[model samples]
Target: MGLEPFSAEDPIFEDEDVLRDSHKPEDLLERDRELEEYQSALKPVIKGARPRNIFLYGQTGVGKTVATQLIMDRLQEDQEGYDNLYVRVVHVVCKNLNSSYQVAVKLVNEFRGPNNKVPTTGYPPDTIYEFLWEHLKDVDATHVLFVLDEVDAIGDDDDILYELPRANDNGNVPADETKVGVIGISNKFTFRDNLSARVKDSLCDEEIHFPPYDANQLRNILQQRAENAFVDGVLEDDIVPLAAAFAGQESGSARQALKLLFKAGDIARSRDLEKVKEEHVREAEPKIKESQVRNELESVPTQSHLTLYALLMLERQEDLPAKSSDIYEVYEIAAKRIDADVKTDRTIRDRLSQLKLKGFLDVDEHNEGPKGGSYYLYEFGDIRPDMVEEVLRDVDRLEDLFQKEITSY
Candidate 1:
C-alpha cells in the first residue's frame, strides 16, 4: 500500500461520541433479568399499598444507582392516576452526610428546596428530625421512598434509616397510615451486619443483591455504547472486547469500563489518530489506574487523611518501620495543625486499621516476646514517597485554611 501522507504515530477514530457517553443501567445491554427484578420491587407502590424497605448491596459501579433511578422513573409515571398515592422519592448520597443529624438536616433542606439551607453541623438531632417530619407531612408524602446511596458512610448513625421506616409508628403520623419505605444502597455487604439489631430489622424488609457484570456482559454493554456513542467504523473490532476484559478483571464496573473507552479515545485524539485501536486501550491503562488512585486519595475521610499524613511524615524522618505510638504523636500534631478534631489514640489506631483494610497502607508484625521481643510496624504501599509528599503539601495548604477558621473563632 502507498503511503497515505498521515503520521504513523497517530491513530484516527471512525467516530468520537462512543467515548463520551455516560452510561446508565438501561444503557447496559443483556441485563434484562436484573432490570425486571428491580422493576418488580417497586410494583406494590403502584397499587397504593405500603412499600417494603429495600437494601441494595453490590460492588461499586455495578448499576445499583442507575437501576434504582430507572425503576423510580417508571413508578412515578405509572402512579399518576392513583388518587391516594402520595408518592415522593428523594435520593441522598451519604458519602458526605456522615452524621444522622446531618442526614436529617439534609432531608429537611431537600424538602424545602430553594428557600432554605441547613447548617451541616450546627443543628440539634431532635430539632432536625422534627423539621424533616413536618416537611414530609406538609408534602403529603405519606408513601415516602428514600434512597440513601453509600449508606455505609453514616457508620454507627443509622437513625435515619431505622426511624424513617418507623416514623409513623413513633407518632410522627398515624400508627399504621403514614407509609415510609427506605432503600439503603451500600457497596459493602457488611454495612447491614454492622447496623444495630433494631435498625437492621426495620430497614431490611427486602434485600436486592446486584452482582458484578461478567466479561461477556461487559462486552455486550460496551458494544451497545459503541453503536450509539461512536461514529461508524471509528473503533477497531478489538477495542471493545479489550476494554471489556480489562474492566471485568479490575472491578467489573461499567463506570471503569466506560472511563477506559473515553481515555483511549482522548489519547487517540491527542495524537491526531483517525481510529481508536486495541493499542490505545493498552496505552491508557496506567493513566486510568493513576486517575483511580488520585480519586481514592481525594475522597478519603478528613481524619483518615490526617492519619496518613502523619505516617508519610514519620516515614520521611526514619529508616525502619514506625510503631503505632510513634505515629500517634505525629498524627496528633498533624490534626492540631489542620485544626481538625482529634480522636483518641485508640481511635487513630482504628482509623489506621481501616486504611489498611482499604489497601492504602501495609502493617508488619515483629516478635519481641523474648530476645527479639514483640513489636508491630506500619508502612505505606503502592503509594510512593514523592506522591506522599505531594499529598502532604496539598494537605498543608488545607491546614492553612483551617488556621484561618480557628482565628475567626
Candidate 2:
C-alpha cells in the first residue's frame, strides 16, 4: 500500500535530530587513511601483544571522535569470538568530571552492571580505584582499552591515567597474562607537558596527532552529512561551501560546519522551502555562538558559575569591576532568583579567589594611602558580561525545569 503524503506545507523530513547528528564521527566520511592508521596501531593488541598506551591529540571537531568510533566498530567486528580477549573500551569525556575520583567512579559504574551503582561523591579514592580494578579483574578480559577524551579536564588528577596501564604489570601477573592499553585523546597538546614526569612516561607510549580539517576536508564532511540529511538535490550547491568556509575560518571544525548546515536546513524545511539558503546560514551563526557560550557556562566550576551570574547582573545594572561588595550583593540576588542557597560573603570571596587562580577573573589589589581601607576589585578575564547574562538565563531556565524534583527529593 502507498503511504499518504502529508500536505504540501509539511516538511519532508519530520524529525530534526536526524539532521543534527548526520555528520557524527560514526557516520563520518573520507577519513579512511586515519581509520587505517589507528586500526594498525590496535592490531598488535588484538593479536595478543602486550597492549600499549596511545595518545591522540587533535584540535576540536576535526574528526578525532569520528575516526575513533569507526576504528572501534571495526575492532569489535573483527574480534567477535575471541573468548580470551576481554576488550573493554570505555570512553569518558573529562569536562564534566573534575577529579580523578569522579572519573574512577564513572569508570567503575560503566564497568559495573545494573545491580551495582557506585556512589557519586565521598568514596575515598583508594576504595574506588580498588573497586575498579576488581571489576576489571572480574571481567577477565585480556585487553582493556580506556579511552579518556579531553584528559586535561580531569583537573590535575592523573592517578587513573597513571595506574590503568600498569594494572597487570606489578609482578602478580602469573608470569604470563594478556595486556592492557590506554588511549588518551585530548585537544590540549601541552596537557602531557604539564603532567608530572612519571605520568608522561606512562600514558603516552605511542602518539597520533589529528590535525584540524582543511576547507576541502570540511566540504567533503558536509557533503557526506548532506547526503544522509536531505532528500536528493534538496540542498543547494552553495550550502556546502558556505558551511565549510565558515567552519574552516573558525577552527577547521567539521562538527561546527555540520551544525551550521543542519541548522540552516532546519530553517529551510521549517519554512516549507525547497533548499537551504545563505540567509538561513547567516541566521544560524548566532544560534551556534549562543550554544557555545551556554556549553562553556555549564562546564565552569560552581563558584565561577555564581560569580558569572553576579557579574552579569552588575553589568546590566551598571558598569562593573564592580566593587567586591557590589558583586556580593548581586550574587545574593542571583542566588535567591535561582532558588539556590545564598552562600556567605566569605564563601563568595573564596570563589572569586579560585576564579582568579584559574585565570577566569582578575583580582586587582588596592591599598589606600596610609592606614586607609584596602580591598581588591573583581572582574572577568575573558568572558563577556552579556554572554554571562545569557548563560545565567539559560541556567535559570534549565533549573526551572528540574526545580520541583530537586525540592521534592
Candidate 3:
C-alpha cells in the first residue's frame, strides 16, 4: 500500500536543511567581495602575526557569517600544508551571551569538561578571565581568532572587546604567546559606533559592510539553494522567481528567499501536489511571516519586546503605525499591567532604533509642511497583529487583552 498522510514517494526536498538560515552552503553565490575580504583578514595567521580585528556589519541574510565561516574553514585547512602556520580558529555565535562577563565565562567553559563547565551566571569577570587565560596558555596554535557573531549582544561591555585583542598587553598571555585576533559580526550598524573609543580604535581595525541582495542576486541564490534542496522538475517555472521577487522587494534578504522557496515546497507537499507552484507560494507567505515575526520579537532585548508589545496594542484598533508619543503612552500602560518598570521616553526611542536595525520594525520620519517639525512614527516591519497576538498569548497578563481586544480588533 502507498503512504497515507505522509507520502513515501519522492518529495520535492532532498534535504530540507539546504535552505535553512544556519546551513553553510559549500559555495556562496553573489558575495565575491565579502569572501575576498574574509580571506584577506585571516591571511596574517599564515605569517604568525595577529590578524586585524575585523568588523563585519550587515543586514540579516546578507552572507556576513557565511563568508566568514568559509574563510575560517579554509584557514584551518591551509594550515595542514605548513608546519609553521598553526591557526586555531575558535568561532562562537555570541548572540545569546549578553554581557562581557557572560562572554568571558563562555570562552572559559569551552575548554572545560562538560561536567565542570561554569554556571551560566555568578562568578566575577576577573576570575573568568583568568580561567580563559589558563585555557589559552596551553594552546599549541600560533594564533587564535575569536569570531564573535552578533557581537552587539554584549551591550556596552568593553571588557571582552578590549581584552581579547590586547590579551598580551594585559599580561593575561605571555609576550611571545599565541597572538589573538577578534572578528566581530553584527547586524546592528550602530553597534560599532556605540563601542568604547579604545575598543573601536583597536577591535575595529578592518571593517567590511555587506549590503542587501537585489532581485537578480536573490534569484541566483535561490536557484543554488533549490538545486541542492530539491529534485529536478520538482518546482514550477514561477516558484523560484516569485519567491525571490517577494524576498528581494521586501527584505532583500537571501535567507528570506531560501525560506520562502522551502515553505512553498512544504505547502505543496502537504497538499499532495505533484509540483510546487505559485499558489503554494501564496499560501506560504503569511505562515512564514508569522514565524519570522515571532522569532524576531523573541530574540530582541526584554525592553524591546515590551516596546513591540505596546506598539501591537496601539495598532489593534487601527492597523496603522503609531507615533513615538503614542507608543510610549501604550508602553507605560503595558509596563504597569505587566508589573515591569517604565523606561524613559529617550530610552524607548533607543529601543526602537535597535529594533529597527534588527529588522523587526520600521521607523519613518515625516516632515509636517509649514508649522510642524519632523516627528518619527513606528510600524512593525512586515509583522502582522495576529502574529503579535499569538506570541502575546503566552504571557499571562497579556492573554486576556489579546483574546478580548486584539483578536476582535
Q: Which predicted model would earn the best lDDT?
A: 3
Clashing pairs in 3: none
Error of 2 at 165 (Å): 2.0
38-119, model 3: which lDDT tens digit per residue?
7787677777776778888987888888888888888888888988777777888898787888888878877788899999
Q: Give per-model TM-scores.
A: 0.82, 0.72, 0.85
Candidate 2 displacement at residue 79 in angstroms: 2.4
* TM-score ranking from best candidate downward: 3, 1, 2
lDDT of all the models against the reference? Answer: 0.76, 0.71, 0.80
Judged by whole-model lDDT over C-alpha atoms, candidate 1 comes out at: 0.76
Q: Please, what are the lDDT tens digits per residue for candidate 1 over residues 1-409?
A: 9866756343344444555434453454666777776667767777766777888888777888888887888788877877867688998988877778777877888877575777777767888888877776767665888888898888777888888877766778453455677889998755666788898788877778888888788898888776766557778989999999998987788878888988888788887677888889999987886667666676666777888777776666763368888888877876777678888999888878877876778899888768887767889876776775566456543555334432111
Better of 1 and 3 by TM-score: 3
Best by TM-score: 3
By lDDT: ranked, best first: 3, 1, 2
